[model samples]
Target: MIITLPTILSIIRLFAGFLILLGFLLLARPAADILAFVVFVSAAITDFIDGYIARKFNLVSELGKILDSIADKILVIMAWIIIITYYEFNSWIILPIGLIIFRELFISGLREYLASKSLSLQVTFIAKLKTTLQMVTISLTFFSGIIVDGSGSLTTFLLQPVAGSGTTLMEMACIVLIWLSAIQTIYSGWEYFKTALGLMGTKNDG
Candidate 1:
Protein backbone atom coordinates (compact mmCIF):
# COMPACT_ATOMS: atom_id res chain seq x y z
CA MET A 1 0.00 0.00 0.00
CA ILE A 2 1.20 3.48 -0.84
CA ILE A 3 2.01 5.62 2.15
CA THR A 4 -0.79 8.05 3.04
CA LEU A 5 -1.53 10.60 5.73
CA PRO A 6 -3.94 8.32 7.52
CA THR A 7 -1.53 5.42 7.41
CA ILE A 8 1.19 7.65 8.75
CA LEU A 9 -1.01 8.73 11.64
CA SER A 10 -1.80 5.09 12.38
CA ILE A 11 1.88 4.32 12.44
CA ILE A 12 2.49 7.22 14.77
CA ARG A 13 -0.21 5.93 17.08
CA LEU A 14 1.33 2.46 17.12
CA PHE A 15 4.71 3.84 18.16
CA ALA A 16 3.14 6.30 20.59
CA GLY A 17 1.59 3.42 22.47
CA PHE A 18 5.00 2.08 23.43
CA LEU A 19 6.23 5.49 24.46
CA ILE A 20 3.16 6.04 26.58
CA LEU A 21 3.72 2.69 28.21
CA LEU A 22 7.27 3.57 29.10
CA GLY A 23 6.29 7.02 30.36
CA PHE A 24 3.43 5.72 32.48
CA LEU A 25 5.69 3.14 34.04
CA LEU A 26 7.77 5.97 35.45
CA LEU A 27 4.77 8.22 36.08
CA ALA A 28 5.76 8.75 39.68
CA ARG A 29 7.92 11.58 38.39
CA PRO A 30 6.25 14.70 36.99
CA ALA A 31 8.27 14.77 33.80
CA ALA A 32 7.37 11.20 32.93
CA ASP A 33 3.70 11.71 33.68
CA ILE A 34 3.65 14.79 31.47
CA LEU A 35 5.35 12.84 28.73
CA ALA A 36 2.83 10.04 29.03
CA PHE A 37 -0.08 12.43 29.04
CA VAL A 38 1.10 14.29 25.96
CA VAL A 39 1.73 11.16 23.95
CA PHE A 40 -1.41 9.42 25.18
CA VAL A 41 -3.76 12.26 24.37
CA SER A 42 -2.13 12.98 21.03
CA ALA A 43 -2.45 9.33 20.04
CA ALA A 44 -6.08 9.27 21.15
CA ILE A 45 -6.82 12.28 18.99
CA THR A 46 -5.11 10.72 16.00
CA ASP A 47 -7.22 7.60 16.29
CA PHE A 48 -10.30 9.51 15.24
CA ILE A 49 -8.52 11.83 12.87
CA ASP A 50 -6.88 9.04 10.88
CA GLY A 51 -10.09 7.12 10.42
CA TYR A 52 -11.93 10.22 9.34
CA ILE A 53 -9.20 11.14 6.92
CA ALA A 54 -9.17 7.67 5.43
CA ARG A 55 -12.91 7.65 4.85
CA LYS A 56 -13.00 11.21 3.58
CA PHE A 57 -10.09 10.83 1.20
CA ASN A 58 -10.97 7.36 -0.06
CA LEU A 59 -7.74 6.15 1.45
CA VAL A 60 -9.16 3.21 3.25
CA SER A 61 -7.26 0.14 2.17
CA GLU A 62 -6.95 -3.32 3.65
CA LEU A 63 -3.66 -2.27 5.18
CA GLY A 64 -5.22 0.83 6.70
CA LYS A 65 -7.95 -1.26 8.25
CA ILE A 66 -5.45 -3.70 9.69
CA LEU A 67 -3.12 -1.01 10.97
CA ASP A 68 -5.94 0.97 12.58
CA SER A 69 -7.25 -2.01 14.47
CA ILE A 70 -3.78 -3.13 15.53
CA ALA A 71 -2.82 0.33 16.68
CA ASP A 72 -5.99 0.73 18.70
CA LYS A 73 -5.38 -2.60 20.39
CA ILE A 74 -1.78 -1.88 21.22
CA LEU A 75 -2.51 1.53 22.72
CA VAL A 76 -5.38 0.58 25.01
CA ILE A 77 -4.34 -2.97 25.82
CA MET A 78 -0.85 -2.00 26.81
CA ALA A 79 -2.14 0.87 28.89
CA TRP A 80 -4.40 -1.48 30.80
CA ILE A 81 -1.64 -4.02 31.20
CA ILE A 82 0.65 -1.43 32.69
CA ILE A 83 -2.11 -0.02 34.87
CA ILE A 84 -2.80 -3.34 36.56
CA THR A 85 0.90 -3.96 36.85
CA TYR A 86 1.26 -0.64 38.63
CA TYR A 87 -1.65 -1.61 40.81
CA GLU A 88 0.40 -4.58 41.93
CA PHE A 89 -2.07 -7.05 40.42
CA ASN A 90 -5.07 -5.96 42.41
CA SER A 91 -8.10 -8.14 41.71
CA TRP A 92 -10.41 -5.15 41.23
CA ILE A 93 -8.15 -3.60 38.63
CA ILE A 94 -7.32 -6.91 37.00
CA LEU A 95 -10.88 -8.19 36.57
CA PRO A 96 -12.17 -5.53 34.20
CA ILE A 97 -8.88 -4.80 32.50
CA GLY A 98 -8.18 -8.48 32.05
CA LEU A 99 -11.60 -9.11 30.56
CA ILE A 100 -11.12 -6.27 28.08
CA ILE A 101 -7.65 -7.49 27.17
CA PHE A 102 -8.83 -11.08 26.74
CA ARG A 103 -11.69 -10.06 24.47
CA GLU A 104 -9.32 -7.96 22.37
CA LEU A 105 -6.93 -10.88 21.88
CA PHE A 106 -9.73 -13.30 21.17
CA ILE A 107 -11.29 -11.04 18.57
CA SER A 108 -7.87 -10.29 17.10
CA GLY A 109 -7.16 -13.99 16.64
CA LEU A 110 -10.50 -14.48 14.96
CA ARG A 111 -9.68 -11.66 12.61
CA GLU A 112 -6.37 -13.31 11.73
CA TYR A 113 -8.08 -16.61 11.07
CA LEU A 114 -10.60 -14.94 8.83
CA ALA A 115 -7.82 -13.06 7.05
CA SER A 116 -6.06 -16.32 6.28
CA LYS A 117 -9.22 -17.46 4.51
CA SER A 118 -9.32 -14.30 2.43
CA LEU A 119 -12.00 -12.79 4.62
CA SER A 120 -12.16 -9.84 7.00
CA LEU A 121 -14.12 -9.05 10.08
CA GLN A 122 -15.56 -5.63 9.48
CA VAL A 123 -15.48 -3.61 12.64
CA THR A 124 -18.94 -3.25 14.12
CA PHE A 125 -20.41 -0.16 15.76
CA ILE A 126 -20.12 -1.79 19.13
CA ALA A 127 -16.49 -2.59 18.52
CA LYS A 128 -15.76 1.02 17.71
CA LEU A 129 -17.68 2.13 20.76
CA LYS A 130 -15.64 -0.18 22.95
CA THR A 131 -12.38 1.23 21.67
CA THR A 132 -13.50 4.83 22.14
CA LEU A 133 -14.74 4.20 25.63
CA GLN A 134 -11.66 2.23 26.55
CA MET A 135 -9.44 5.05 25.38
CA VAL A 136 -11.35 7.68 27.35
CA THR A 137 -11.44 5.50 30.43
CA ILE A 138 -7.76 4.73 30.28
CA SER A 139 -6.94 8.39 29.75
CA LEU A 140 -8.90 9.40 32.82
CA THR A 141 -7.37 6.62 34.84
CA PHE A 142 -3.95 7.90 33.97
CA PHE A 143 -4.89 11.45 34.83
CA SER A 144 -6.30 10.65 38.23
CA GLY A 145 -3.61 8.17 39.06
CA ILE A 146 -1.04 10.90 38.59
CA ILE A 147 -2.70 14.33 38.94
CA VAL A 148 -5.91 15.83 40.44
CA ASP A 149 -6.52 17.03 43.99
CA GLY A 150 -9.04 17.44 46.82
CA SER A 151 -10.64 20.88 46.44
CA GLY A 152 -12.37 19.58 43.34
CA SER A 153 -11.18 22.49 41.23
CA LEU A 154 -11.14 19.58 38.84
CA THR A 155 -7.78 20.52 37.47
CA THR A 156 -6.81 17.95 34.90
CA PHE A 157 -3.74 15.76 34.31
CA LEU A 158 -0.68 14.79 36.26
CA LEU A 159 2.00 15.66 38.85
CA GLN A 160 1.74 19.28 39.83
CA PRO A 161 -0.11 19.28 43.15
CA VAL A 162 -3.11 17.14 43.96
CA ALA A 163 -4.93 16.13 47.14
CA GLY A 164 -7.64 13.80 48.45
CA SER A 165 -11.34 12.87 47.95
CA GLY A 166 -11.51 14.59 44.52
CA THR A 167 -8.75 12.42 43.23
CA THR A 168 -10.47 9.35 44.61
CA LEU A 169 -13.68 10.40 42.91
CA MET A 170 -11.90 10.76 39.62
CA GLU A 171 -10.31 7.36 40.02
CA MET A 172 -13.68 5.87 40.86
CA ALA A 173 -15.16 7.42 37.75
CA CYS A 174 -12.40 5.91 35.67
CA ILE A 175 -13.09 2.49 37.16
CA VAL A 176 -16.76 2.72 36.30
CA LEU A 177 -15.90 3.71 32.76
CA ILE A 178 -13.47 0.81 32.50
CA TRP A 179 -16.11 -1.69 33.57
CA LEU A 180 -18.62 -0.18 31.17
CA SER A 181 -16.12 -0.46 28.38
CA ALA A 182 -15.36 -4.03 29.36
CA ILE A 183 -19.04 -4.94 29.08
CA GLN A 184 -19.18 -3.41 25.63
CA THR A 185 -15.99 -5.22 24.71
CA ILE A 186 -17.57 -8.57 25.53
CA TYR A 187 -20.70 -7.78 23.59
CA SER A 188 -18.68 -6.68 20.56
CA GLY A 189 -16.48 -9.75 20.78
CA TRP A 190 -19.57 -11.94 20.74
CA GLU A 191 -20.87 -10.04 17.73
CA TYR A 192 -17.62 -10.66 15.90
CA PHE A 193 -17.70 -14.30 16.91
CA LYS A 194 -21.17 -14.69 15.48
CA THR A 195 -20.03 -13.17 12.22
CA ALA A 196 -17.03 -15.47 12.15
CA LEU A 197 -19.20 -18.53 12.77
CA GLY A 198 -21.50 -17.57 9.95
CA LEU A 199 -18.52 -17.17 7.68
CA MET A 200 -17.41 -20.66 8.65
CA GLY A 201 -20.92 -22.12 8.02
CA THR A 202 -21.67 -22.67 11.70
CA LYS A 203 -24.77 -21.03 13.05
CA ASN A 204 -24.20 -19.17 16.30
CA ASP A 205 -27.23 -20.39 18.17
CA GLY A 206 -26.18 -18.81 21.42
Candidate 2:
Protein backbone atom coordinates (compact mmCIF):
# COMPACT_ATOMS: atom_id res chain seq x y z
CA MET A 1 0.00 0.00 0.00
CA ILE A 2 1.22 3.43 -0.93
CA ILE A 3 1.69 5.95 1.86
CA THR A 4 -0.58 8.79 0.82
CA LEU A 5 -0.72 12.40 1.99
CA PRO A 6 -3.98 11.82 3.79
CA THR A 7 -2.52 8.89 5.68
CA ILE A 8 0.46 11.00 6.66
CA LEU A 9 -1.81 13.84 7.84
CA SER A 10 -3.89 11.40 9.88
CA ILE A 11 -0.69 10.13 11.49
CA ILE A 12 0.26 13.70 12.31
CA ARG A 13 -3.11 14.25 14.00
CA LEU A 14 -2.59 11.17 16.18
CA PHE A 15 0.84 12.39 17.21
CA ALA A 16 -0.59 15.80 17.97
CA GLY A 17 -3.15 14.23 20.29
CA PHE A 18 -0.32 12.58 22.19
CA LEU A 19 1.43 15.94 22.37
CA ILE A 20 -1.66 17.62 23.88
CA LEU A 21 -1.82 14.91 26.57
CA LEU A 22 1.89 15.31 27.22
CA GLY A 23 1.46 19.07 27.50
CA PHE A 24 -1.05 18.55 30.27
CA LEU A 25 1.55 16.66 32.26
CA LEU A 26 4.41 19.10 31.65
CA LEU A 27 2.67 22.47 31.78
CA ALA A 28 3.20 23.77 35.32
CA ARG A 29 3.74 27.53 34.91
CA PRO A 30 2.38 30.28 32.68
CA ALA A 31 5.13 29.54 30.21
CA ALA A 32 4.19 25.89 30.27
CA ASP A 33 0.60 26.86 29.48
CA ILE A 34 1.88 28.80 26.50
CA LEU A 35 3.61 25.67 25.34
CA ALA A 36 0.48 23.64 25.81
CA PHE A 37 -1.50 26.19 23.87
CA VAL A 38 0.87 25.82 20.97
CA VAL A 39 0.56 22.06 21.02
CA PHE A 40 -3.22 22.23 21.18
CA VAL A 41 -3.59 24.74 18.37
CA SER A 42 -1.27 22.66 16.24
CA ALA A 43 -3.33 19.59 16.91
CA ALA A 44 -6.54 21.39 15.98
CA ILE A 45 -5.01 22.59 12.75
CA THR A 46 -3.90 19.10 11.86
CA ASP A 47 -7.45 17.84 12.31
CA PHE A 48 -8.79 20.18 9.64
CA ILE A 49 -5.83 19.81 7.36
CA ASP A 50 -5.97 16.03 7.44
CA GLY A 51 -9.61 15.89 6.47
CA TYR A 52 -9.22 18.51 3.78
CA ILE A 53 -6.23 16.76 2.31
CA ALA A 54 -7.94 13.42 2.41
CA ARG A 55 -10.81 14.67 0.29
CA LYS A 56 -8.74 17.00 -1.86
CA PHE A 57 -6.35 14.25 -2.78
CA ASN A 58 -8.95 11.50 -3.05
CA LEU A 59 -6.83 9.48 -0.66
CA VAL A 60 -9.52 8.52 1.77
CA SER A 61 -9.02 4.93 2.87
CA GLU A 62 -10.65 2.65 5.41
CA LEU A 63 -7.57 2.86 7.57
CA GLY A 64 -7.53 6.65 7.31
CA LYS A 65 -11.17 6.93 8.31
CA ILE A 66 -10.77 4.68 11.32
CA LEU A 67 -7.56 6.35 12.43
CA ASP A 68 -9.01 9.81 12.01
CA SER A 69 -12.05 9.04 14.16
CA ILE A 70 -9.87 7.46 16.83
CA ALA A 71 -7.53 10.41 16.85
CA ASP A 72 -10.39 12.89 17.18
CA LYS A 73 -11.93 11.02 20.11
CA ILE A 74 -8.61 10.66 21.90
CA LEU A 75 -7.77 14.32 21.49
CA VAL A 76 -11.15 15.53 22.70
CA ILE A 77 -11.31 13.10 25.63
CA MET A 78 -7.75 13.79 26.72
CA ALA A 79 -8.28 17.52 26.55
CA TRP A 80 -11.44 17.24 28.65
CA ILE A 81 -9.64 15.10 31.22
CA ILE A 82 -6.76 17.55 31.43
CA ILE A 83 -9.04 20.57 31.84
CA ILE A 84 -11.17 18.93 34.54
CA THR A 85 -8.06 17.80 36.39
CA TYR A 86 -6.45 21.23 36.19
CA TYR A 87 -9.46 23.11 37.44
CA GLU A 88 -11.44 22.74 40.65
CA PHE A 89 -13.56 19.62 40.32
CA ASN A 90 -17.09 20.64 39.39
CA SER A 91 -20.16 18.52 38.69
CA TRP A 92 -20.92 20.78 35.72
CA ILE A 93 -18.10 19.41 33.63
CA ILE A 94 -19.32 15.90 34.32
CA LEU A 95 -22.56 16.53 32.44
CA PRO A 96 -20.79 17.44 29.25
CA ILE A 97 -18.28 14.63 29.59
CA GLY A 98 -20.94 12.12 30.30
CA LEU A 99 -23.02 13.23 27.36
CA ILE A 100 -20.04 13.16 25.05
CA ILE A 101 -18.88 9.69 26.09
CA PHE A 102 -22.36 8.22 26.02
CA ARG A 103 -23.11 9.66 22.59
CA GLU A 104 -19.89 8.35 21.12
CA LEU A 105 -20.36 4.89 22.52
CA PHE A 106 -23.98 4.74 21.47
CA ILE A 107 -23.20 5.94 17.99
CA SER A 108 -20.39 3.45 17.64
CA GLY A 109 -22.73 0.62 18.60
CA LEU A 110 -25.37 1.89 16.21
CA ARG A 111 -22.83 2.08 13.43
CA GLU A 112 -21.85 -1.52 14.05
CA TYR A 113 -25.44 -2.64 13.94
CA LEU A 114 -26.11 -0.72 10.78
CA ALA A 115 -23.00 -2.09 9.16
CA SER A 116 -24.17 -5.58 9.91
CA LYS A 117 -27.35 -4.64 8.02
CA SER A 118 -25.36 -3.30 5.07
CA LEU A 119 -26.12 0.31 5.92
CA SER A 120 -23.97 3.38 6.50
CA LEU A 121 -24.61 6.79 7.99
CA GLN A 122 -23.28 10.08 6.72
CA VAL A 123 -21.66 12.61 8.99
CA THR A 124 -23.84 15.66 9.46
CA PHE A 125 -23.13 19.41 9.49
CA ILE A 126 -24.24 19.75 13.10
CA ALA A 127 -21.70 17.15 14.05
CA LYS A 128 -18.98 19.31 12.52
CA LEU A 129 -20.22 22.36 14.40
CA LYS A 130 -20.22 20.42 17.64
CA THR A 131 -16.65 19.33 17.03
CA THR A 132 -15.58 22.90 16.29
CA LEU A 133 -17.14 24.14 19.50
CA GLN A 134 -15.51 21.35 21.47
CA MET A 135 -12.11 22.19 20.06
CA VAL A 136 -12.51 25.89 20.73
CA THR A 137 -13.77 25.37 24.25
CA ILE A 138 -10.96 23.01 25.12
CA SER A 139 -8.32 25.29 23.61
CA LEU A 140 -9.62 28.39 25.37
CA THR A 141 -9.91 26.63 28.71
CA PHE A 142 -6.32 25.44 28.37
CA PHE A 143 -5.14 28.98 27.57
CA SER A 144 -7.24 30.49 30.35
CA GLY A 145 -5.09 28.62 32.82
CA ILE A 146 -1.95 29.85 31.13
CA ILE A 147 -3.21 33.41 31.39
CA VAL A 148 -3.20 32.93 35.16
CA ASP A 149 -0.28 30.90 36.45
CA GLY A 150 0.51 30.07 40.06
CA SER A 151 3.35 28.09 41.53
CA GLY A 152 2.36 24.97 43.51
CA SER A 153 -1.21 26.25 43.49
CA LEU A 154 -4.30 25.71 41.38
CA THR A 155 -4.78 29.45 40.80
CA THR A 156 -3.93 30.55 37.28
CA PHE A 157 -2.58 33.92 36.22
CA LEU A 158 -6.06 35.03 35.23
CA LEU A 159 -7.31 34.33 38.70
CA GLN A 160 -4.51 36.28 40.35
CA PRO A 161 -4.01 39.46 38.42
CA VAL A 162 -1.31 42.08 38.89
CA ALA A 163 -2.01 45.25 40.83
CA GLY A 164 -4.31 47.66 38.89
CA SER A 165 -5.21 44.85 36.48
CA GLY A 166 -8.51 43.09 37.12
CA THR A 167 -8.84 39.38 36.45
CA THR A 168 -12.63 39.42 36.64
CA LEU A 169 -13.09 39.97 32.94
CA MET A 170 -10.94 37.04 31.98
CA GLU A 171 -12.65 34.79 34.48
CA MET A 172 -16.04 35.76 33.16
CA ALA A 173 -14.97 35.09 29.60
CA CYS A 174 -13.69 31.67 30.50
CA ILE A 175 -16.85 30.88 32.37
CA VAL A 176 -18.95 31.89 29.40
CA LEU A 177 -16.99 29.72 27.02
CA ILE A 178 -17.15 26.77 29.38
CA TRP A 179 -20.89 27.06 29.69
CA LEU A 180 -21.35 27.54 25.97
CA SER A 181 -19.30 24.42 25.41
CA ALA A 182 -21.44 22.47 27.81
CA ILE A 183 -24.60 23.51 25.97
CA GLN A 184 -23.18 22.65 22.60
CA THR A 185 -21.95 19.34 23.93
CA ILE A 186 -25.42 18.34 24.97
CA TYR A 187 -26.98 19.59 21.76
CA SER A 188 -24.51 17.71 19.64
CA GLY A 189 -25.05 14.53 21.57
CA TRP A 190 -28.79 14.79 21.12
CA GLU A 191 -28.40 15.38 17.42
CA TYR A 192 -26.18 12.33 17.10
CA PHE A 193 -28.56 10.16 19.07
CA LYS A 194 -31.52 11.28 16.99
CA THR A 195 -29.75 10.54 13.77
CA ALA A 196 -28.55 7.18 14.99
CA LEU A 197 -32.02 6.20 16.14
CA GLY A 198 -33.50 7.25 12.84
CA LEU A 199 -31.09 4.92 11.16
CA MET A 200 -32.19 2.07 13.43
CA GLY A 201 -35.91 2.73 12.85
CA THR A 202 -36.42 3.94 16.37
CA LYS A 203 -37.96 7.15 17.62
CA ASN A 204 -36.10 9.38 20.12
CA ASP A 205 -37.72 9.17 23.53
CA GLY A 206 -37.97 12.35 25.49
Report per-prediction Cα RMSD to one decimal.
Answer: 4.4, 5.4
Clash count, one per candidate: 1, 5
What 10-residue stretch in candidate 1 is worst by lDDT? 152-161
Give the alpha carbon lDDT tens digit for every residue of 10-124 in model 2.
7777777678666657765666567667877788888898889888879899888888887777777777776666545656666666666666666667777777876677888
Itemize residue pairs with steric clashes in candidate 2.
148-156, 148-157, 148-158, 149-156, 149-157
Which candidate number would show the highest TM-score if scored against the true structure? 1
Model 2 residue 75 lDDT? 74
What TM-score fits each model? 0.84, 0.80
Runs of candidate 1 with Cα error greater than 4 angstroms are 25-27, 148-152, 155-167, 202-206
Q: Which ranges in model 2 have alpha carbons more than 4 Å from their true place?
A: 149-167, 202-206
Error of 1 at 78 (Å): 1.2
Candidate No. with top lDDT: 1
